[model samples]
Target chain A: MIGRLNHVAIAVPDLGAAAERYRSAFGATVTGPDALPEHGVTVMFIELPNTKIELLAPLGADSPIAAFLARNPAGGMHHVCYEVDDILAARDRLLATGARVLGTGEPKTGAHGRPVLFLHPKDFDGTLIELEEVA
Target chain B: MIGRLNHVAIAVPDLGAAAERYRSAFGATVTGPDALPEHGVTVMFIELPNTKIELLAPLGADSPIAAFLARNPAGGMHHVCYEVDDILAARDRLLATGARVLGTGEPKTGAHGRPVLFLHPKDFDGTLIELEEVA
Candidate 1:
């Protein structure tokens, strides 16, 4: 079952500009522009009291967010991650509900280097969802 | 300055179906169908451990989310609300940075009955952001 609301990911056209914008305008604690080449994106976190806003920029041609950026050139909210216990069990539950999971339906190393899986956007009311195993 | 992430608002086409999908698929604590006719939308909350996921649907023809829904028929992330210490000050800071605020540059009562202002998505890396004044 879902537990905490992990982070909201936004794909941005410019990572540094986006990070700087938050830091200067919102006075948020901006951290990282960590590039995850394997994930094909560079990320920065705007740390908040209760949650985080993740800024993502495509790292390569095959980057998962590349297509999204192509669709929304200015970038946009990509997905929302939710913390879940027992990743396998959660996948099973989602499958039982006839919802489709992305990729091989297997958890992969996410930006946090934790097991994570993405659910099909169509099944989730047109919102992409990522479930990360927390415990 | 920004504090907590008040909530992530997702505009859905069907409030009931979206709430039910989350409750049944994600095992989330879903609440409401609270119609804010004044705001021209109905809402529901998926209570999470640290924050909330707000599900919204258009209430009438003049609904703010109607255009958003028209573009994204199924649903999509509408805007993210961040808590601010003093919204007027926050607006001034954002304006000083040349960031544009939506509406008449005035804070209005938000769905939570708090003074809030929306920032232009173009000025925010293509993401609509709401700043709510929180004590």
Candidate 2:
């Protein structure tokens, strides 16, 4: 079951500028400067009360983040994440309900070394949703 | 500093159906059957730990939810909120940055008697953002 919101991902054309803007806007402190090679982008997170605002910028033209930016030039909000206790159980239920799971099985490490899984946007009414388990 | 994400609002075509689907998928419990007349919509919140999934359906065509649904028929995610310590201070700083505030002063009351205010979508790159003080 979904536990709590984990983070909201935003695709930015430039991660540095976006991070600076948020820090200036909310006095948010930076958590990390990390990259997920599989996703082909770099990310920075600003930790908040129950979640964080993650900024993603593509490392190359072939990156998914690049494609997302090409479709949304204004850099709109990208996805919402929910924390779950059991990733596999949640995946099973979502799959049973016809929700498209991005992967075939259990989750691997995601941003910040946390286990994560993504539900396809098509299955979630056009909003890409991610499920993460921190503990 | 901002700590964690509070909630993300999604404007739906039908609240009852959306709520039902969510319940069936995750076994989530319904937390509210309330209305925010000021926002012109009847909302149902499905509480999940640190946040809740708020389903908003317009009470009338003039309601913002109606307009949002009219623009996006497939349904889409609406907003992201951050829980803050001082609403007034946050408002003051946001104003200083030239962000457009929907309400001129401190938050009055929102969906569930929680103090709330909205930042115009234009200022936040086309995503309507709401700030709520849940504590």
Candidate 3:
């Protein structure tokens, strides 16, 4: 089952502007342009007291978020992540309900190096949901 | 300054279906169909351990989210709310950065009964942001 609301990701056209704006606008701590080449995106974390806001920018032409940026050039909320205790059990439970798990239907190592899976947006009322298993 | 991620609001066409999916998919607690008709919204809170996921449905013709739902008929992430220790001070800081605050630039009572302000989506990378004052 989903536990905590992990982090909410926003896909931006420019990571630097996004980070700087959060810094100037909110006087908040912003960290990283950490590039995850495997995922084809660079991310910066806007650290908050309770949760994090992830600013994502396309790292390559084939980046998964490139299309999202194309549609929303100014950027927008990309996905919402929730923590689950058991990845396998959670996957199975969601599968039983006929909800689709994206990718190869296997958990992949996410930005945090935690096992994570994406659920079909259509099945979840148009929201792309990422489920991360946290110990 | 921004502190906790107060809640993430998702605008859904069907409040019932959205709440049900979250409940059945995550075994999460879903509460309320609380109608804030004054705000032209009917909402349900998907309670998570760390924060909450707010499902918003248009309650009347002039519902603020009606246009959002029209654009995203299947439902989508609406806006992200962050808690501010002193909203007035926070507003001034953001304003100094030339960031445009939505509406009359005055705080309004939000869904949770906290004084809140909305920042222009264009100013925040096309992502609508709500700043709620919290103790």
Candidate 4:
């Protein structure tokens, strides 16, 4: 059901600063620091060899990332994302195994125009996991 | 200073059950699932492309993973790990950038024959991050 690790999401207070830190420390370059209006967060992705490190900062109070940051004031790790070959098949399997899907609707295009879906933290044992099918 | 993603650490209450669930859902095989006496927990790894999903369950009260599980009972997501080429250098640079290193000691071999080091959640803003230099 899962392919590679698409990306690892980190919630930051400032995206530009985090991206600069990553670049200076690891020689990683930001791929896309695009603003996800629907998700209400601005995401900056630093491309690594096998996986990308995502820097997420909440745009406002209504954004999920902001809510997460509020809950974790120190702003530690955020979420784990897995690359799935078939989003629908993976979702169905997760559901069959009693995992709760965050969205009852279809998977949508995410930060990089990839088809993405989320499994609620409740079903996955408090982890907000994302399943993305990279095009 | 990194290799491929060694594994993702997820804090769970029941290692056995979660492992079973993963096998059932993704046809994945657990690699280690071994207990790290020093870390005070048992870890089960589900291998996938470019990364491994780690299921971390506490063996006793003193385990860090157990503490994490306690804080987040619903058991959502845990931490993100990056494959680093040199654990020592990575640690040094991160410290230089005002990032806190969890251990002031040398990198040690983990569940597998991999050298692993952890960055403090304080430095990364509430995220417990790990760096592994895989052999």
Candidate 5:
């Protein structure tokens, strides 16, 4: 089951500008510009008291965010991540109830170095949901 | 500035079916089918350990969610709300930084009966940001 709201990811055309806005306007601590080739994103985290905001930019033309940006040139909310106690258990439970997990239907190492899986947007209405196992 | 994440709102085509999915699949405590005619939406809250998920559906043909659903029939994430210590102060600061606040730049009573202001999605890289003054 879903635990804490880990972080809400936003796809941005300019990661640095987005990070700067959080830094200067909101005074949030901006961390990372970590290039995650596996996820095909360059990400930055805006630290908050209770949760974090992830700013993502496409790493390549083939990146998923790239397609999102192509449609929404201004970029937008990409996904919402929820922490789980056990990734496999959560996946199984969701699958048993007919929820479709994205990707290879297995957990993969996420940006946080924890196991994560994405749920199909179609299954959850229209919002893409991500489940990350707490490390 | 933003405080805690108040909730992530998802616009669903079928409010009851969406609430049922959360209750039966994730065992989330679902509350409300509260109709806010001002916002032209009916909403439900899916309680979580650290945050809540708001499920929204169009209350009328004029509802904004109806437009979103017309484009995305499956439903999807609508907006993210963040709590602010002082709504007025937050609004001034954001405006000073060239961020355009939506709807005549005035705070309206949101679902929680708290003063809330919305920031333009274009200004924030396409993610509609809501700042709610915690009561």
Candidate 6:
């Protein structure tokens, strides 16, 4: 159902500092500070040879990352994304197995401009799993 | 520097059920209920095409997973492991940047029989990071 590991998303109180850490410490290529109003996050991508790291900061008061930061003031690992060949098919298959998909059960444009959906953390042994459709 | 995502570790109260979920739901190849007494955890790996998912359960009363399960009852994402070319060099680089490596700042033999070290969650924006020296 899941393909390659797309990226790991981290919620950070200070996105710039987190990006700098990856840049200076690992010499990673950092890109974007793009505001994703629909997702309520301002994101940056730290690219690596195999996978990418996403740094997310709250974009508004109701941002999910803001709530996460409130619980863990320093920010933390928010989610892990995996690529799927067909997200809708994956969703349907998962749903058939009693998995809960987050949001309106519809795929939305993700940071990579690909369709993505989040699965309920409780259903995935407490890990928030994101499924992104591979283009 | 990180090479690839080695695995995403999830702390589960019941490793068998979690492993079964992946096996039955996604038809993933699942292996191990191996007990790592040194780490105080019993672990299983759900092998995906690209990356693996590690399901962790407490091996003893002193197990870290026991503590995590105490707080989260339902289990959750514990840590993310990334591969590195050189363990010592990565350690020195991370330390020079004031990153706190967990435990004794030395690599321990991990599940994959590789030298691995954990970074402090607090220092890493609340994300527990594991760096494994790939063979």
lDDT of candidate 4 over A1-135, digit per residue (tens): 667777778888877777776777666777667877877888888777778778888875588777677777666667777778888888788878887778664898877788888877766667777888865
Candidate 1 global CA lDDT score: 0.92
Among the numbered candidates, top DockQ falls to 3
Q: After superposition, how far is residue B93 of candidate 1 from its true place, in Å?
A: 0.5
Expressed as tens digits, the lDDT of each residue in A13-71 for candidate 6 is 99888888877766668898999888789999987667778999999768877878889
Q: Per-prediction DockQ scores? A: 0.89, 0.56, 0.89, 0.60, 0.73, 0.66
Q: Compare candidates 2 and 4 on TM-score and give the better one.
A: 4
**Which segments of model 6 are wrong by more than 4 Å?**
none
- Give the higher-TM-score candidate: 4 or 6: 6
Cα miss at A87, model 6 (Å)? Answer: 2.0
lDDT of 3 by residue, B1-135 (tens): 779998999998888988888788789999999999889999999998889999999987899998988889999999999998899999999999999999999999998898999999999999999999987
- Ten contiguous residues with the weakest lDDT in model 5 chain A: A20-29
**lDDT digits (tens) for residues A1-135 of candidate 1:** 788989999999999999889989988899997988998999999999998999999997799998898899998999999999899999999999899999999899888989999999999778999999996
lDDT of candidates 1 onward, in order: 0.92, 0.75, 0.92, 0.75, 0.87, 0.85
- Which residue pairs does candidate 6 place in steric collision? none
Q: Give candidate 1 misplaced runs (Cα > 4 Å).
A: none
lDDT of 5 by residue, A1-135 (tens): 668889999999999999888776666789999998887999999877788889999996578788889998999988999898999988888988899999899898888899999998888898888999995
lDDT of 2 by residue, A26-79 (tens): 788866568777778888887776667787777755786676788777677888
What shift in Å separates residue B74 of candidate 1 from its native position after superposition?
Answer: 0.7
Cα lDDT, model 3, residue B34:
99
Give me the displacement of residue B94 in model 6, in angstroms: 1.6
Tens digits of per-residue lDDT for model 4, B32-68: 6688877788888888867678888887668866666
Where model 3 places Cα greater than 4 Å from the true spot, the runs are none
How many clashes show up per model?
0, 8, 0, 20, 1, 0
- TM-score, chain A, per candidate? 0.98, 0.86, 0.98, 0.86, 0.94, 0.92
Residues B1-135 of candidate 2: C-alpha lDDT, one tens digit per residue: 454566777777767777776787777887665777776888888787876677777775578777677877756788877777777788788888777789566696876577878888666545677777756
